[model samples]
Target chain A: METQKTHILRRLFFSTLYLSAFTFGGGYVIVTLLKNRFVDQYHWIDEDEMLDLVAIAQSAPGAIAVNGAIVVGYKLAGLTGVAVSVLGAVIPPMAILTVVSYCYDAFSTNPYIAAMLGGMRAGVGAVITSVVYDMGKNVVRAGDPVNVVIMILSFCISYFLNVNVVFIIIAVAVFGALRSVAAQKAGERS
Target chain B: MICLRLFLSFMQIGCFCFGGGYAAMPLIEEQVVTANHWLTMNAFSDLVTIAEMTPGPIAINAATFVGTQVAGPAGAVAATCGYIFPSCLFVTLLAYVYTRFRNLSLIQQTLASLRPAVVALIAKAGIGILIAAFFVNGTFSLAAGNVSFRMILYFAAALVLLRKAKLNPILVMVLCGAAEVIFYCAGTLIR
Candidate 1:
């Protein structure tokens, strides 16, 4: 029985390590990758649970990759599992970045390197575009004038107006919470 | 003192930045722009351009550039350390709580709502980049007024080649830079 427990712990820790090494696209990409690995590859979490996990992970903060790792870890091995997984994922990226920073000044001006980076900028633009395209459906809300207005207004404010994003997030959260409460109150009245 | 402050400010950014890197922008702007006043808005804008033009991530670039400015190399180290700490801490804490209520409905709903917002943030950043890259000094200026119909065609052709083929980004960058060099050399030869 103890051996079985140890084996499970090993599998969980190794899987987390595997993800950290391979994962890309950052943030939401983690949700998709982990869902496949956890639910399909490892058989640790079921499909329904995976969906819930994605939602919860998205709602929480920090890098999505780290959040997803924590959620997946906890599902697999309780608190200890969570600790191992999160650390497993976070350590590798941080370490790699640290090493790169040390060398950046030396390479920052190489024209060949600059050319590659110029290419990366365009590629990143495409990747970011794909992300926005996926999310456009959620904000537009099927031709609902109100949502359309909110988005356009938000864009204009964000773009032309130069309004800050933090204020917008707070406003949206407050309005949403209040609306939900009011809707619940109205239901009680009826 | 400046180096210490640079490190601590980014550390605070690392700690409090909850959503994603985009979410960190406000804190970054506040610290780099408002509190420390190390970078003017124009310089901040340029730093962002340089950041986007480089690799890794925007937050990382900001930390390095701002760090270098404040206290040279040591400042860069401090800022980088400060920037990544919150994520390391938050993810660690989250690992503990992710299991018991994994099936919570409210959590799922909130995530669904948040995903769209994440998309919005990305879009906002993209628009900002487009503005910054194409719009120079608060106006549109591309390759000096030499952007003829042919130049537009070249860009369109490049876009097509990219979308229709599995071309590598590094290769595409090389091809585009080569094209620019060729164009410049041709113009010089003409003169």
Candidate 2:
């Protein structure tokens, strides 16, 4: 059992490090890649578990990718798992960005870097679109019209009106809590 | 003292930022750019661009860059730890409660409703990034001289490869970057 625990920690660390190093764009994109690796490849987490972790990660404060990593890590191997996972998730960004900081002036002026980034940005946009679609399909397929409505309203509020996201999250969360209470009462009555 | 302030301010940003990393942008902008004046608006924008181009969470990258700029490597570590501290603490607590109470109806219903909202936020964020990438000067300009059609083509190709071919994301990004370099080099040759 002791050896097994250490082995799990090592595996979790390396996998997360690999994921964090390669993933570009946003947290949602990393979530997708993680599903492929952890769920599909490693069997460390199943589909529904992965989905739940992601939802929690999104709703929680801080970076979704790291939040997801920590939760999944904790589930797999407890506190040690969380520590290793966070370290793995963090090291790549800190190390790479710190190096980039040293050559910041040269990087900003390089035309080749500029061109590469331009294409990558557009590609990143498209990748994000794919993530949104996959996530939306899961939500919409659950057959909740209220959820569908909230999804549309949230988009309209944020995209068109430029509302602060914190307000949107608070409003949605309040609605969710209220709906839960209402459902509880209805269930008791029935 | 500056390091202490940096850590505390980032902790505040970390606590309130929801809907994922991109959503943290405005909060980081408010704290670093407006409140602290650590970086100017132009520099912040550049930081975002660089953050996007690099791997890892944009917020983490921003924290590192801003922290490094303000103090040094130590500042970077302090700011990052401060930023992620809430997440580490809260998520661990949540995992404990959620696993135990997952079957409770109230918890179930709340998660059900929250799922769609999370999806919406992701969609909205994606569209925002897309608009930033594809639009220029508040206009949807796709002209050859203005926005690079090659980039759009690259975007379309990437989408196809990802969805149809099921290519790895890292590979897709590399291919896009390589294609852009080739295209730019060719353009220069022709000119």
Candidate 3:
């Protein structure tokens, strides 16, 4: 039984480690990679649970990638799993950045590097736009008036009004709770 | 003392950086670029490119890069830990209670509401990044000029590759980066 636990822990760590080390473009890419590995490859989490985990991760504070790892890790092997998975997700980036930081001056001044970065920035921008489109399709329901309003309002406030995101989150959470209560009350009446 | 300060500042960022890494960009920009003066705006932009090109979360990568820029390796460790500290704590607590309260209607509704908001936040972040990348003058209006046609071309090409051809992100990045180098080197020679 103990051996089984250890084996799972090792697998969790290596898988996360592998994902973090190789995957670039960040955020949703990592989530998709995790889904492919855990849900499709390992069969650790099912399709439905993976979706729920992503939703929870998306709503929670911190990086979605880290949050996803935490949720899946906990589901698979409790606290220990969480620890190993977080470590796996974090270490590779930390190590890579540490090295890059050490040579930043060199990276900054090199014309070739500058051009490469210039191009990479555009590519990265495209990737981010793609994430927004993919996520917006799922999250924005034209059929659901409330969701549509919140989505549009949130974007306008953030982009146009330049409102602080913390305030927006607080307002939305309060609205959500109230909406929930109203929904339940309406259901009870029927 | 610097390490402690780094830890505290990043911990605050970690706590408040809701929605995810991209959404955290503005907050991070305010803290590191404007408030702390740890890095100039140009440097911060460069770091973002580096963060995207490299593996890991953008927030984590930013924390490490900014910390290292401000201090050193110890600073990197301090900042990285501080950034993730909230996540480790919150996710654990939430994970425990969430399993038991998974059926709670309030929780479900809260999540439902938050999802659209998260989408908006990500969209805002995406636009912010796009403006930063494509608009060389730092203004949203193209009439202000300084628009980089090359950047736009690259962006369109990459978007097409990803959306139409369904190419891998890594491949797109590599191809674009290489194309830029070749273009720039060739331009210099022709000039």
For each candidate in turn, the TM-score is 0.69, 0.73, 0.84
Q: Which one wins on DockQ?
A: 3
Give the DockQ-based CAPRI class for model 2: acceptable
Q: Going through the candidates in order, what is chain B's TM-score? A: 0.63, 0.66, 0.81
lDDT of 3 by residue, A74-160 (tens): 989999999999999999989989899888889879999988877777787787788778878876545788898898999899778
Evaluate residue A26 in candidate 1 and report its C-alpha lDDT on the 0 to 100 scale: 47
Q: RMSD of each candidate?
A: 5.3, 5.1, 3.4
With a 3 Å backbone cut-off (N, CA, C), the pairs that clash in candidate 3 are: none
Candidate 1 clash figure, as a count: 0
lDDT of 3 by residue, B24-51 (tens): 7766775786568998655676787788
B115 Cα displacement, candidate 1 (Å):
5.1
Interface RMSD of 3: 2.7
DockQ comparisons of all candidates to the true complex: 0.23, 0.48, 0.58
Q: Model 1 misses residue B182 by how many Å?
A: 7.7
